[model samples]
Target chain A: EAGVAQSPRYKIIEKRQSVAFWCNPISGHATLYWYQQILGQGPKLLIQFQNNGVVDDSQLPKDRFSAERLKGVDSTLKIQPAKLEDSAVYLCASSLVGGSEQYFGPGTRLTVT
Target chain B: QQPVQSPQAVILREGEDAVINCSSSKALYSVHWYRQKHGEAPVFLMILLKGGEQKGHEKISASFNEKKQQSSLYLTASQLSYSGTYFCGTEGAGSYQLTFGKGTKLSVIP
Candidate 1:
């Protein structure tokens, strides 16, 4: 079976610029998630989608970050006015269901200068 | 809240044994383990629920202690492929959100 897929394995943007990352989860997966991993740290949950609806996004910075999974199969995460602190890897994962094992994508490494 | 992992890093020769521990301050519903190589996505290891059941994958096994809100990963007779950063993700009671630990770096050499 194919695993989660993501685009632009690497990205570079200037501070205050906008950037977007894409994710296509495993087929038939019901739950999707977005996470941010800073250097030397574990991935932090940014948002979660259960099908086409969002289940959790409490940790996400609404002022700058946003994500959506319109069809429940693919999702996108966007960051506007990116800050230097936003330089990190953006990972996308999917699970058969909530609270189940998650399979992660290769991730998009964003470098904000 | 984020979980705490111990022995931030460890080095071992092949055929050795090592243990990585993870503890959470809040009540836990489940604990998930994953290993990630440099610049790679994390690979799922195993999940231990609140029942305190122990799960194993190959030479790697894990145990979850509900009473103590802690989990430990045991790697016995380690191989070179075992070298990576291990993370423990925890979910609180009645919640599905997983908060992860800083990670434990394990290096196995021949």
Candidate 2:
């Protein structure tokens, strides 16, 4: 079976510019999540969605970051007015349920100069 | 809060044993174990829920001590394939977010 798919494996943007990443989860998966992994650090949850509804996004930077899971099959995460600190890998994952193991995509490595 | 992982890195000889520990400040609802090889996505190892006993997946065994809010990953007779970074993600009480540890890098030399 195909695993989770993400677009634009790598991205480079300037500070104050905007960037967006996309994800196509595994077939039939019901839960999707977005995470940020800074260099040499473990991934931190940014947001989570169960189908078309968001399940959690408490850690996301509401002032600059936003995400949506439209139609429950694909999702997008956007960051506006990017900061230098936003230069990290954006990972996308999906699972059958909130309690199940997640399958991750290749991730979009964003470099904000 | 983020979990604390012990021995930021470890180097083990093939067939040797190793243990990685994770401790949390807040109460944990469940602890999940994942292993990620360099440049690859993390693969799930096991999960130990609150009030649940120790759990084992293949040769990789994990124990969740709710009283201490700590969990440990045990690799017995380690193999070269065990080389990777191991991260422990804790599901905090009443929270859906998974606060992951900094991760422990394990290098198993054959």
Candidate 3:
């Protein structure tokens, strides 16, 4: 079985520039999540979607960060004005409805210089 | 809030044993353990809920003290494959967000 999939495995952009990351969840999975993992730190939840609807995004930075799961299968996370601290790995994960064990993708390593 | 992980890092030879501890300030409902290698996403190891008590898989197991809001992961007869950074993700009563710790790096050498 295929695990979660993400595109643009690595990205490099200047600070203040905009960048976007894409994710394709595992087939039949109902929940998708985006997480930011800085160097030497664990991944932090950025957003979560349940069947095309947002279940949680309290930790997301509304001013610069946005994410959407339109068809409930594929999702995208965007950063309008990136920052130096935004240089980190962006991970996408999916799980069965209310399932605690999540399958993660390769992740997009964003480097904002 | 993020839980506190002790020792920050550990080093052991093959066939050795090590214990990693995680503690939270607030009451926890569940604790999830994951391991990540350099440049890779974290791999889920196990989850320990306050109610489930002690659980483990193979040589790796975890114990949770519900009253103390503490969890300890046990690694016995460590192997080179077990070398990685360990993180404890904690969940509260009714939140979806998982606040993860800084992580504890473990290196197993032969």
Candidate 4:
């Protein structure tokens, strides 16, 4: 079975620049999530989607970050006007409905200089 | 809120036993554990559901105490391959997304 897939395993951008990351979740998975992991820390939920609609984004930085799941199959997370602190890994994960385990992608390591 | 993990780091010799704890202020419906090596994605270890019971997977087992909203991961006869960061992701009783703890860094030495 294929796991969640993400694009651009690594990205480098300057402060004030914008960056986008993509994710293609495991087929038939009904839930998708985006998380940010700063160095030496655990993953923090940035947003969650149930199919094509967002279920939770309360922790997302509204002014600078946004995410969307299209057609309930793929998702994208964007960070605009990146900051030095944004130099962390962006992880994507997916799971079956009501399932306890989540499959994670390789993640995109974004370095904002 | 993110769960809290105790003993930010632990170093143990191979064959020794170590324990990592994860506690949350909110009521937890489930607790999921994972291990991630440097520069790698987290690999699922085990999941403890409600009922406040203990679940064992391989040489690693976990206990969930609903009354205290805490979970603990036990590594017995630790192996050199056990070196990595362990994270506990908790699903609150009323929440959908899993909120992960800071993590416990474990280093099993030879």
DockQ of all predictions against the true structure, Cα-based: 0.94, 0.69, 0.71, 0.76
Candidate 1 pairs with clashing backbones = none
lDDT of 1 at B86: 99
Cα lDDT for residue B97, candidate 1: 86
Best-fitting candidate, scored by TM-score: 1
Worst 10 residues of 4 chain B by lDDT: B92-101
TM-score of 3: 0.97
Residues B23-101 of candidate 1: C-alpha lDDT, one tens digit per residue: 9999999999999999899999999999999999689999999999999999999999999999999999878889999
lDDT of 2 by residue, A1-103 (tens): 9999999899999999999999999999999999999988999999999999998998999999999999999999999999999999999999998866888
The CA lDDT at A71 in model 1 is 74
Superposed by TM-score, candidate 2 places the C-alpha of residue B88 at a distance from the truth, in angstroms, of 0.3
Candidate 4: segments with Cα more than 4 A from true spot: none
In CAPRI terms, model 1 is classed as high
Instruction: Please report the TM-score between candidate 2 and the true structure.
Output: 0.96
Q: Which candidate ranks first by DockQ, i.e. highest? A: 1
lDDT of 1 by residue, A38-75 (tens): 99999999999999999999999999999999878899
**lDDT for position A26 in model 1:** 95
Which stretches in model 1 have alpha-carbon errors above 4 Å?
none
DockQ of predicted candidate 3: 0.71
Looking at model 3, residue A55 earns an lDDT score of: 85
Model 2 off-target regions past 4 Å? none
